[model samples]
Structures are given as C-alpha cells and as structure tokens.
Target: MVNRHRGETALMVSGETLPMRLTLGALAELEHAFAVDSLPALGERFVEGRLSARDIIRIIAAGLRGAGRAIRDEDVAELSFDGGLNGVIKAAIALLEATFGEDDASRPPQPPA
Candidate 1:
C-alpha cells in the first residue's frame, strides 16, 4: 500500500503534461496564422491606439484555427518562455506598432450629431 501511495503521489506531483511535439505544432500553426491574417488587423488597431497588450494576445490566439483544441491560459503562460508562442505574438505586435505609428487618430473622426 505504501508503494501504491508513493506512485499516486508521484503522478499527482507530475501534474497534467502536454506533449512537447504537439505544443510545438500548435505554436507553429498559431505563428503562421498570425502572420497571414491577424497581424495586419492587429497592426491597424495598434496604429489606431485601440489595441492593448491583452487585446493583441487574445486576437492572436483567436486567429489560430484548426490548429488543435483551444489554447488555454496555462498554455499561454507556458508559451511565454524563450522561443515560444508568446514570444511570437509579442514580436508580431511590436513589428506592427513600429511599422505603423499612432497616426490613425489624426484622421477625421466620424460625426455623430
């Protein structure tokens, strides 16, 4: 009974493990989708000062489709490490911000009389 208890404890300590390869695949797909679709929109929003950091992250995750199951907060946290999905998302956001200065606000606003 002691050995069984120890085994169970070990399993519990290990926690839920995500497969490394699967995670990598998901990250790659997310990166690709962001590059193709969401990045431009995010950039536009940033230029307009309408995109927050959290909003950028959420948009990137939402842009990922048919990659796998929905990415959870835990996955986002895990991906924030070096060479991870979070890094990719941040990079994309930075690129957009740099490329498009906050000039959208200069445009004439729509009248709502």
Candidate 2:
C-alpha cells in the first residue's frame, strides 16, 4: 500500500514488508548518480517511463535508504523479488510515485474564485 502522507510505499520483499520512498538525501544521491542538474531533470528523464536496468537499481537503492535501510545497488540487485520482474517494476513505480507523487492526485487543490 502507498502512504502519501508519509511518502512511503509498502512492498513484500523476500517475505518481509519493506517501506520504500525517496528522502531528500536519497534524491540527492540519485541526482549525483545520474549527473542531473536538478531533480526536475531526473523526473523529466523518466517521464516517458523508459528505464534502463541500472536506473532500476539506483532507484531501488535510493528507496531502500529512504526507508531507513542502509543498502547498496549491489545488494538490491542480489535480492529475489517474489513478484518477479513485474513485482520489481511495481515497486519502482511505487517509489517514483512516493517521491514525485502521483501527478493529478498530488496537485494542490484549486481555490474557487
């Protein structure tokens, strides 16, 4: 389940429920890894939904750290996903949503004139 308020998304990892999200520190790490000028660039790069395997590892690593798990990309790559590739993809989506938010659902409410 995704917790918008807490910026956390729960995922079953090797029979354990792990919470994933992107903290400021995690985001910075990603920015450095990707060599992007800003967070928006990072977001924009994935806006089209195309991600390389390395991208997935980076995102997952950052997410694990955000959830207070001190893990590296190598560790993430070595883990087994119960949901398989699709499950990993779902977790990635959850992480992205938790980080950048779910587009329309995240937009601030418009005030009535």
Whole-model lDDT per candidate: 0.38, 0.83
Q: State the number of backbone clashes in model 1.
A: 0
Q: What lDDT score is found at residue 60 in candidate 1?
A: 41
lDDT of 2 by residue, 44-77 (tens): 8768799888898898889888888888899999
lDDT (10s digit) by residue, model 1, range 68-109: 336653445344334455544554453333334344456688
Show model 2 residue runs off by greater than 4 Å.
1-3, 103-113
Q: What local lDDT score does residue 103 receive in model 1, on the 0 to 100 scale?
A: 47
Counted clashes in each candidate structure:
0, 0
Off by over 4 Å in 1: 1-44, 66-69, 83-86, 94-113
Instruction: Tell me, by TM-score, which candidate is best.
Output: 2
lDDT accuracy of residue 83 in candidate 2? 92
Clashing pairs in 2: none
